[model samples]
Target: MIEALAPVFAGPLDFARHWLELAEAPEPLPRRPIALSTLLEEEVQRPLMARHEARYPGGDRRAALSMWTQYYCAQYLLSHLGAWLLLGRMLPFRPDDIAVLVLEDGTPDGFRLPHLGAVAEGPVDLEPLIREHLAPLFQSLQRHHRIAPRVLWTNAAVRVSAALNLARQQPDVPPLRLLEAEALLAKPCWRDGSPNPLHGTQSRVEVEGEMVLRRRVCCLRYMLPGIAGCGATCPIKEGQSAKPLPLLKSA
Candidate 1:
C-alpha cells in the first residue's frame, strides 16, 4: 500500500499513518489548542537534539537545541512543505491543521496535511495554492514558535531548494521541472532580509571561486560547541563576507 503511494511523495521522507490520524483531529478537535511548533519542539525537535548530542557528544545544551530546532525545522519543511512545492500544491495552514511526523530519533519524518486531500490528489496550480494556503501556515508557525514569519518561510524555501537539487541528482522520479517550480518561487515570499524566498527557485550557488549552495540563514548548527562547522551553504562561515541571502548571482 505504501509503495503504491511513494511516487507522489518527496524523497528520503515518509509518514506514519498514526500521526496522520492525529493531525486530522478525528472529527473532534482536541480540548486544547494545537500549537505546531511547541508540539514539534517537545515531541520532535528536542528529542532529535538529544539523540544527536548523545551520538556526537559535546555541545552547549541550549545552543544545541536551537541548532537542532533549526535543522529539524528545515527537514520538516523539506519533506512535507516541499512535497507541495514539487507538486505545486498547498496544504492547510491553521494551527490544528498543520502537524509533523517524526522518526524515533526525533528527526522530522514527514507531515500530515489536514484538509489538503485535494491538493495532494493533484492537478492544481502552484502560485495561487502557495499564496492562499501556505503563506498563512508560515504566519501561524511564526505565532506558535515566536520565530519571524520570514525566518520560517526561508527555512521552508531552503529545504525546497535542496529537494529540487536532490531530485535533479537522483532522477529516480520524473525530474522536477525546475523552471516550472521557479514560477512558484518567483512569487513573492518572505526571508530573513527580504520579502522574497531566498532560494528563489534556484539551488546551486557560486561563492569565492567555488560553487556552493549556501544556507540563506545560519541554521545555527555551528553554535553548538564541537559540532562541525556550518553547512557548505552557510554564508557566515569563516572568511565568508556575504549576508546569507539574495541567493542567485547575476549571469
Candidate 2:
C-alpha cells in the first residue's frame, strides 16, 4: 500500500505519510504492536487503562480514554481522508486489517497496515468508517470505562473535521474534494438517516478579528495532571473548573 501511494505522500500531502504506513513481512512487526481488533477485547483494554491511570495518579479514567480516542481517530481519519482527497484512492481502513503501535505504557504510537483493501475513488463515503470502525471501538471503550459515547463520537468528529480542513488547504487538492467535504458537514444526518455525529462538532468564532475554529465538545484533557487544555480551540469556558465530567452511566 505504501509503494502504491508513494507519489501521493510527497509534496503537499507529506503529512499523511506519517499517519499511515505499509509494512513488509507482516509478522514480526516492529515495536510492541497490537492488532486493533485485539485492543477491543475487554481483557486487553483493562491493563491499558490501568497503565494510563497509573501515569496520572489522580486523573479521571474518562479523560485518559478520551485523549487516547483522539489519538487513534486522528491517525486513521487524516491518513484515509488525505489519500482520498489528494490521490482519489482509499487505502484499507477496516479494523481487522490494521494494527497500531503501542508503547510500553499503553499509549498508541502510530498505525501499521499489513495488508491493503480495495481502493475507491474520490467522493468516498465516510459511513463505513463511522459504522465499521469507530462505533464498535467507542462501544468497547464505554463498556470498560465511564466515558460517554457522545464524548467519544465528538472526539472522532473533531479528527474528521480536521482531515477535511487539512485536505482543503493543500494547493493541489481538487475542487470536488472541497465540495464533498462541505456537503458532508452540511448534511444533518448520515446516509442511514441517523443523526450525523460529525455535524455541529465545531464552530467558528472571532478571535481578535480572526475567525478561529473551536470544538463544541471539550476533550477533558484539562482533568489530567500536568496536561494543558487545548487553548483557544477548547470549548471549555474561561475560569471553568478542570473537573472530569460526571460519570455517565452506561446504557
Candidate 3:
C-alpha cells in the first residue's frame, strides 16, 4: 500500500530508480503498532510532566502538562491521521490499521511527536476512526490530566483544524481527494469568519490563492509564555462570543 502511495508522497520514490537499488531495498521500513493509551502515557504525558517540572521549577506543573498534552495530541492526530482526515474519502482505512511511529524521544512536543506512520491494507470507516482511535486518545488524555471532557473536546477541535491546515502545507503529499475539505470549505460558515458549526473548530478554509483556516476557539498557546505569538483570531485578548454562535444554518 505504502509503495503505491510512494508515487504521491515521496518525490524520490515517485521517480524511476536504478534497477540494482530497487532490487536491494525492496521492502519498506518496519512499523510497530502501539495502543493509543500506551502511546499517551509513555510518550506524551510522562515526558511533558517531567520536562515542565524541570524547566519551569514551579507553578501548576500538572496543569501546564495537561495543557501541553491537549496541544500535542492534536498534532499527533494531524500528522498520523492525515491519511484518514485528508485522504480517507479516497484511500479508505481503519483505526486498527493505524500505528504511531515508535520514536527514541519520550516527549509530545512538536519536535518529538510520534507521527501516524503507517496503515495496513484494508477498508476504512470514519465512525470507527473517531470511536476507536480519536475518542480513546482523548479519553486517555482527560483521564491522565483529570481535566473535563468539555475542555479537552473544545481544545481538540483546534488541534484537528490545525492538522487539516498543516496537511495543506505540502499540498496532496498523500494523494488525498480532500472531498471533505471541499465540502466543508464550501459551507456558508466562514463567509463571515466564524467557527459556528465547529467541525474541528474550522470556520473557514480557502482553496485557491493562499489557503487559510480561521479557528473559532483559541488553543491557549498564548498562556504558555515564549512559544509563538497568539494569532489575531485568538480569543484570549478581547474575549470571543462563540457562546451564542453568531449564526447557524448559514453554518
Off by over 4 Å in 2: 1-18, 23-30, 118-122, 238-251
TM-score, candidate 2, is 0.83
Off by over 4 Å in 1: 8-75, 81-95, 102-109, 113-123, 127-150, 170-177, 189-209, 238-251
User: Candidate 3 lDDT, tens digit per residue, 1-251?
Assistant: 23432333333222312110111233333322333445556455566456543432232444455455564555444434454544443232233443343333323322221232345444443333444555676667667666555445556556555555555566553433344443343343444555323355545545356545554555544333333423444545532222321221211
Candidate 3 Cα outliers beyond 4 Å, as residue runs: 1-35, 39-48, 58-63, 84-106, 109-124, 166-176, 181-215, 238-251
C-alpha-based local distance difference test score of model 3: 0.43
Candidate 3 colliding pairs: 80-116, 93-124
Candidate 1 Cα deviation (angstroms), residue 28: 21
Candidate 2 local lDDT, 37-122, one digit each (tens): 99889999889877766666677777888888887787777676666777777666677987777767777766777655556653
On lDDT, the candidate that comes out on top is: 2
TM-score of each: 0.54, 0.83, 0.50
The positional error of residue 193 in candidate 3, measured at the CA in angstroms, is 27
Which candidate, 2 or 3, would have the higher TM-score against the true structure? Answer: 2
Query: CA lDDT, every prediction?
Result: 0.47, 0.72, 0.43
Which run of 10 residues does model 2 get worst, by summed lDDT? 238-247
Candidate 3 Cα deviation (angstroms), residue 217? 3.8
